[model samples]
Structure formats: structure tokens, C-alpha cells
Target chain A: MSEKQLHEDQFYITGLKENNTSVIQAIYKKFVPKVIQHIKNNNGSEAEAQDVVQEVLITIYQQATEKKLQLTCPFDAYFFLLCKRKWLNELKKSSQKEVTFLNENVSKDESLQEMVFQTETFSEKQALFDLMFQQLGEKCKEVLRLSFVTKSMEEVAVKLGVTYAYVRKKKSLCTGQLTQLIRESVHYQSLKNK
Target chain B: MQEEMYFAFEQYLGNEMNLEDRAAFEKKLLEDTYWKESFELYQQTHQFLKTKFSGETAAFKQNLKQIALENQSNKNSSKIVPMYSKWFAVAATVVLFCSIWFFMQSNEPKYVEYNQHEKAYFTARSEGVAILKEAQDAFNTKAYESAVGYFEQIPQANRNEEINLYYAIALLEVNKFEQAETLLQAIKSGNSVYKEKAIWYLGLSKLKQKDYSSCKQLLEVLPESADDYNKAQEILEKL
Candidate 1:
């Protein structure tokens, strides 16, 4: 498909928010073979490739929902880079061994690299947010953590033994508090100016 | 003005303001310089607080220090140390609580379930093709029951018409001629790539059910170019 056609396809696929299983399955069908080929070329098995592909797709879904991910690169190259990096990470984590192969054509795309880097940076920021969530008072921490982690106001309310309105209030306050903290922190100030 | 602004700020920040109150507060933020300045200050302070308290390492260090001091004080008491170490105890309790919460949450239908055959079955059709490697595996292993089970789980919501054709073949293999016939009929009416096979199977199902006339009617609809067209023609002759 032309790059424009692929972009349109991805837009169509990502627009499907209600019944995502079939859209996700379609994306999986189109991209998974290339991912599998990339992984197998780098000393990974088909099964491992399948697991990595699924993880990459799930990450894309979560990012799209929670962070409102937008596509500026072709979906094929972007997906390929993500799966490749994920497999490399798996290899590093499992055996402490490095496997190198000729760079795939997808990796040569500068925009694809930038997209992958942006996703990785967002993931790191989220991880830091999770880490900082532990510093609040137990009640505040529990409420805020459940709000983001569960993505459900009613469930967070039940868990925190509060009314739903109270939970919502607490979440907004907690998030505002967190943002204020980040703004004041020396690290955050430096990072922001950077 | 500052106090009034603070009250409105608290309400707005807490999401406690009604719609009118919210609109008034936002209007003030947009138009009133004094309210805007205080709101900005409040925003700055809130951001500061969040940064200071978000890291788990800080929490872990405090917890560890408290545990060490408690252990030291109890050294002379001759009491048994807790078998569940303090950190492990906390971790275990958290896990248990989360498990209960998740179990309760799971009362809603799960979209995915993992089983070996189900995985293979999905993988076979994951490409949107009618390849029967999974079905053939099930058949070869005499996992007919599981074969039928897997076949039945294909989501009707999005499957192309080819799936119905495969499902009918699976049903026929499992000796579900009645169900197979219904599926084959649906496929025949649709613009399925498997329309020819559906026709052949419809005839076979009717033959199995001893409905010669209906079988003959279906067999006549098979295209001459179909692989099974001659077989269908022969079956019609027999009927």
C-alpha cells in the first residue's frame, strides 16, 4: 500500500474505539508477519515474536487511549521499530546477551526513530509518575494510584472507601498536587527548561 | 477578593463546583486578573507538593528505617520474629487485596481467555484466511470435542463469510449435520468465497438427513467451474 493509504488505514483502525478487537486483529494481521520476520532474523523464535508483537500492540492501544497517541510516521515502520526494540529489550533482560543484525529498512527511517523515541520517553514519564505516586500519604496515594491505574472512578471510590464524587474530587486534587510538585522540583524545572 | 477567589478555586479544583459555579469560576479565571493570579499561585504550589512526594524509594527508605528500629527494640524480648518479614508481609497483603479487587472486577465478561487449542485456532484465522492447520491438528489428535469447541468460539461479530464455510466443514467433521446445514445455507445466500463448498456441503448434509429433493435443488445451484460442481451434478443425478 502507498504510505498515504497506510496512514488512512491506521486512522480508520485507531478511530474504532468501541469494538476494538476486530480492528486490533486487522492491524495484527497486517503488521505481525513483518515483526515476526524481524525477530526471527535477530535470533528470536516465532513464539517470542508473537508475544512481543502482542505487547507492542497493547502498548499502542494503551498509549492511544491514555496519552492520545498520534501517528506522524507510516504505521508499518513505526510498528516495526517498536517490536524490534521490545524484542531487543527482552533479549537483554533474559540472557544478558546482545544480538546484532543488519539494520532493517524500517529502522533507517528518521521519522520512525523519532516516533519510537517519543513513545519511549512517554513510557518513562509514566513510570516516573507511578514511582512518585508512592510518596503521597497512604490515603491520597491509594486514591490517586487507583484513579490512574484502574481508570475507573467508581472502582477507585469503592477501593478508597469514599463516595464516587469524593473519589473524583480527590483524583483531580491529587493530580493537581502532583503537577504542582513536579513544577517546583529542581529536576522538573531543569527538565522543563531543557 | 483573594479569599473569595480561593473559595472558588477550592471548589473548582476539587470538582465540587456546579455547572454554573464552574462557569463563573472559569469566567473569573479568564477575565479577572486577581483571580487568575491566585489560581496560578495555587497551581504552582500544587505542582510543588506532587513532585516532593511521588517516589517509592523515599517511602521504602522510611519503611525500612522504621522496621530496623522496631527490630532492635524487640531484640531483648525473646519473642518470635514474624515469619512473614515486614516487607513481604506488606507485599503479600497488597497482593491479596489486589487479587480480591480484581476478582470482583472480573465479574464483567473477560474479552480474552488463553488456552492452547484456542490460541492455535485463533492463530490459524489470525491472518483472515481459512487455513485449517489448527482444525487439522485437532482432527489428527482426535480432539474432536475441542475442535468443535474452538470452532464455536469464532466471533460472529466481525468474521468474513469464509469463516462460516470453515465452521460448516468443522461441524460436518464433528457430525453436526443439522447445524452445518444452517451455516451452509447462510453462506450460500451471502457473497462468500466459499459459496461453492457451501453448496456441496448443503447437499451432503441433506443426503445425510435423507432430504433428497431439497438436496437436489441446492446441488443445481453449484457453478460449473466449482471443483465440486461435477460431484454435485453426480449427486443430483443420484437424487
Candidate 2:
């Protein structure tokens, strides 16, 4: 992966990272119509199309900004595949009648399929991590959020009215508890092995 | 692994570990592959939580949502836009019909006499081109054709809104109405510095073209903050 050259369409990823409005507008204008049409023809409305497209863009934005997600395929194929998969998943959740799928070309492209799999996996892991983090107790939650966000054990300790040493130990313990909780979850096991 | 071992990982990461303990930890990591994997997972989780909960996340999400909304509106736009532009886009069309009806009845305060073109003294920031000054001067002096000539020579490569706006106005004056309208439409539809001006000028261009229905629709969308808002309102009232 390191040796693989980034596709020119990496501009879309960089554009998303920089929060360039023009690029965002271009994505919606250029690539979103087929996603909308696919959704609308298959048990969806204009409103649902809006939500799916927004969610897909947000996922890409999150991965791009947080994980430094790099695109090695054409953005159109990668983005369309993500939207298509997400909308199909949504349909399954709602238990709607399955409409005939569009874009067989998506699965035919090996590079697009690989890139799409990476983003899907990243999105799933991100969601699972957020869910597992929330299950932590209130004290653990505050300690973890504060430690990670503030990044200063001394400052966190001061804010929490505790000794710096206590903060360090509690910080590690809270995250340790989180790890233990994730390890215990069946969902985590499936995700881990996958 | 014991819970206390996690603190050792944290301490090592925090650069608080003494040399001997650090060396021991490294040896242990190499010796125990499972523990190495767990440590890496913990490290990944730690970094993920840090960024996911950061203060910037909410604002970034909101910005993305707004951009999506604007794009969605642009996509389905025919007579109406969705989201915030909806009310105005529809209202503009409604106002168009009303103004057309009013135009047929009252011959008072004519649209043509109402607008004595304001001498645009504003020197818009454009790429440093010598002819831009002459264009501005020619436009101010009402030498519309020559202004059109100079403004047309300006590089359109950058999609510069200010240049487009001035060029469009010159296009309108030279009776190249269709070209002017297209340029104004592009500028008005996108997020540009000249958006409000583009809308107002589009209305004026339509009015000059004797298409009152189109004129009223465009005029109604000229926000109150626009320079021509009062004039637009007066024209609407008279129509």
C-alpha cells in the first residue's frame, strides 16, 4: 500500500480534508445523481437520498480528516460504491423489498472494491468504538474524554481536583476497562476476526 | 495481562519510563506477540478516542451537512430549491406571477425610468491587469461597447466572480443578453463573493430584455442586504 501511488482523484479526499466547499459541491453535483436515482427507484424518497448522501460524505469526511484516508482509485467509483452499500444496508435494516441493484460495474472493478472495503471496515470500526466507549461508566467516560481531548494529565487532574498521579492511573485504568469491555463483546469479536 | 500493565504502556508512551523499565517493556513486547497486538490495539483505540471526541468534530460535521444541503438544493432546482432556499425560490415564482398581473394594469413608474444606472465607482479587486482600469472607466462613462471589449479580454481562467460580474454587466449593456444571463446565472447559483450582485443584475438584465416574469422572479430573490434592494422593491410595487 505504501508503494502504491495515489490516484489523481486524491484531490477529492484532500478537498474533503480541507473542507473546501467547492469540492464538496462538485462531488454532490457530479457524483450524487446516480446515488439519488438508485435510492429513489428502490424504496426511497428525495429526503432519504439526502440523508444517505450526507451520511456517506460525512463518513468520508471523518475518515479523511481523522484517519488521513487516502484514495487510490477514482473518487466516483469509490464514493458510489460506498453510497450503494450504505443504502442497501439501510434497506435491509428497514426490511424493504429488494429492488434490482444498479451498477454492476462497481463490483467488476477490483481496485474500487478493495478501496470500498477499506472505508466500510473503517466506518464499522469507528461506529463500534464509539458504541463501546459510551458503555463505559460516567467517571470512566469523563476521564477518558478529558484525557484524550485535553491531552494533559496535569491539567485534567487539576480540573478534576485530583493528584496528577491519580489522574494518570485512572486514565490508564479507564481505557483498560474500555479495552476489556470491547474484548468481552461478541460484536467486537466478530469485528476483530473480520 | 494485569490491569496495571496498561499504565506501563501509557507511561512508556508518555515518555516517563526510565531506561531499564523501557528496555524490559520492549523485550516483553517482542517476546509476547499476543500482548504486542493488544498493546497496538490499545494504542489505536487511544488515538481514535482523542480525535473522535475533539471539539472540532461537531463543527466540522455541521459544515459538511451545510455543504451537502446547498448541493442538494442545486441538484433539484427547477422552480424551487430545497432547505433554506425553498421558501424564497417558490416565493420568487409566486411574486413573478403577481408582478406580471400588476404590470398589465398599471403603467405608472416605468421599470426603465426607475433605474438610472449608478456610476459604479467601486474598483473591484481583479488580477493585476492594466485594461481593467480602462474597463471600469469606460463602464462609468457609459461607453458600454468599449467596456465590453476590455472586460472580455480579462482572463476567465480563475472563475473570478468580480470579473464575471463586471463582464456580465458589460455584456448586458452591449445587448449580448444571453451571454450575460448565463454568466450571471453561474455566479448567482454558486457560493461566490458576487452572488447577491449577480442576482440583482440578473433581474435587471431580464427587465431590460422585456421579460417581466423572469425579471420579477430574479428581483424577488435580491435579498434586503443587496445594494439594489430598495430599487427592486420599488419596481415590484410599481409592477
Candidate 3:
């Protein structure tokens, strides 16, 4: 990504933290086109490209929101790698016998392939997290995601159109709820017993 | 911490406790092993919840987009109007026709007088430019609503199709659907490069209003060359 694009992504991530849809749209407008082109060049159709782009953006959104993801590499390379790997996985899962030129090109991107390997290895942890989330109440899940993943309490407040105090209180309540849920989870209980 | 203190502990975990209260809470947490253990549990739960919730959010957004796509395709293939009750449709039509009749009867004399009066003339050349400038400035500042408002203020006569396109986009940003539709209607399709965007938004406006059939119809006509054409087609299908 260019410095300008990097700055835009940073601003977008900040907005997402706050739950600002417009900022998210701006970010979408900036990167989605390039990502789509890259996907198409890699043998994916427009629909596939759209899905890949959305997933990549969502991954970025989630990481930035939860981990307070600081970009060490330019977002372009990192984002491209994630999407490329996801597409490759899809192709592999489909059991295609013949490799297309685009697939070959994607395979050639060694850095991206490495990133994918590093990230994909965490599928087990992700599955666990997904189960825990599913057990949470809808409101609790929403509040926690808003607080940790998106990072914009102000935007969340505005979206919810509730007072800042209410947003804070709700977030705390949701976190507490999740904590209770995790404690009661079968996996956690089994781990404790072990 | 007592059960009653859990709420306070929750606040503390979120860093919402006042400075003095936070300091006192931290001290208590450090001094009391039970409180310290509880806090650690809370921290772990919080971290777990964060990851879980993020994953769920990502899934939800992805699902919403998929739904949109599915709906569009369904609309194109079937053209099935989900049945509204006959009685409801009859009642709506009766109310609409009666209201239009009543409006026409009441406004007939006034319409004649208004038509006879000197046509008001105002040059929008300068004003349109100024408003366009303001809209761009507001967009740059991320003041989406303000940008929409300024864009709307540009006179339709003086505004080029490009300006109208931007105006519709601004209205979309602010979720002002009716205004966007009105502006979009005035811009001729053949000359405007943004015709596809206009059709897409028009369909979206109808979708927002739950006028699924109209949305499907408009979306069906959206040029395949448009950026969102496939997405639009998908939504139309679902509708």
C-alpha cells in the first residue's frame, strides 16, 4: 500500500473500532477494487473475488478490533496474502485436478504463501473461539465485538444512539456475561477437571 | 469482591472505574488473593469473548453480503412477488387514490393561480458551484451528512449529471433515500456515466422501503458493466 493508502487504512481501522460505517465504506472503496483485481488475476471470478475481498476485510477488521492490530507490513501485502491463501484453500477444497496459471502465480508469491501457512495453522483456536462466541447471548456478543474488535466506543454509541455511559456500562455487562459463559463452558470445565 | 461488587469489578475490568475507585480496586485486588484470581478469570474471559465476538461479527457481515447476493439472483430468476394480502393491497390503493383525488380537487384553483403568477427565476450557476465545493469539503472531512446536505442544495437545473451523481452518493451516505431517488430521477441515463450507480441506489431505496418488486425491477435493469451489478443481480434474485 502507498503511504496515503496506509494512512487511509489506519483511519478506517480507527473508524471501525468506533463502529463508523461510512469510514468502513471509505476503506472498502479504497482497497476492494485492487483486491478484486488481484483475485481475478489469480483465476477467481468476480463473485469469488468479492467473497475473498470481504473475507480479507473482515479478517483485518477482526484482528484490528480484537488484537489492536498494528500494521508492521503494509496492509496491502498482508491483506493480499490472507485473501490469496483463502482462495487457494477454496480451490484445493474443490479438488480441482488441473492447476490454472493464476493458481501457479499465487503459488509463486512465496511471502504470501508463508503468511497463509502461519495464519491457517490457528484454525483450531479459531474454532474454539467460535464455539464460545455462539454460546454468548446476542447482546453480549454484539457489545464485546464493538468494544474489542471494532475499537470505536464513540461510533458504537452513535450507532446505538445511546449515551456514552450506557455504552460503557453495557460493554462491561456483556464482558461479565461472557466471562460467566466461558466458566460454564464444557471445554473450560473439562480443562479445569483435568 | 462480593456479588454486589461484581458490577464494580466489571467496570474496573473495562477501565471505566474513576481514578480514585480504580486505585482502591487495584489495591484490593492485589491484597486479596480471591479478588486477584477472579480478576484474572475476568481477564481471560474478556480475551476469549473478544476473539469469539470478532469471529462472529466477521461471519455475520459475510452472511449479510451473501444474503444480499442470493436475494438479488432469486429476484432475477423468479420475478415472484411475495404475496401481500388482497385486502391489504385493496385498502392501500383505495387510500392512495382517494388522497390523490382529494389533493387534486383542493389544489385545482391554487394550481391555476400559481401557474398564472410570474415564474420565479434564480440563477443557480454560482450557487451550484459553491454547494458542490462545500459538499466536497464536507466529504473530505468525513462529515457525510453535511456533505449530503450541501450536495442536495445544488440546483437541479444548473447541476450537471456528475454533480447529481455525487449528490445521490452523498444522500446514500446519509441514508436519505427519498432525496437520492428524486435527484437520481432527474439525471438522464444515456449521458450520465453514473446511470448504473443511480439504478443501483434506486433499487436499494426500494429495498429499504420494502418495495421488493420495484427494487427487483430497477435492479434488473442495472448495467452489467456497473461495479455492483453482480451484487445487485443477487439482491434482485432474493427479492
Among these predicted structures, which one has the highest lDDT? Answer: 2
Docking class of 3: incorrect
Question: Which sequence of candidate numbers ranks them by DockQ, best first?
Answer: 2, 3, 1
lDDT agreement with native, every candidate: 0.61, 0.80, 0.62
Model 2's alpha-carbon lDDT is 0.80
What's the lDDT for residue B83 in model 1? 55
TM-score of chain B of each: 0.42, 0.50, 0.41
Q: What is the DockQ of each candidate?
A: 0.02, 0.37, 0.15
C-alpha RMSD of candidate 1: 23.3
Question: Which scores better on lDDT, 2 or 3?
Answer: 2
TM-score of 3: 0.37
What is the C-alpha lDDT profile of model 1 across A116-149, one tens digit per residue? 8767665544445555555556877666556545
lDDT of 2 by residue, B26-71 (tens): 9989999977877887776787776677766666677778877776
Per-residue lDDT for A77 in model 3?
Answer: 64
Mark the 10 consecutive residues where model 2 chain A has the least summed lDDT. A97-106
Candidate 2: segments with Cα more than 4 A from true spot: A65-68, A102-106, B18-21, B75-77, B81-239
lDDT of 1: 0.61
Give per-model CA RMSD.
23.3, 17.8, 22.7
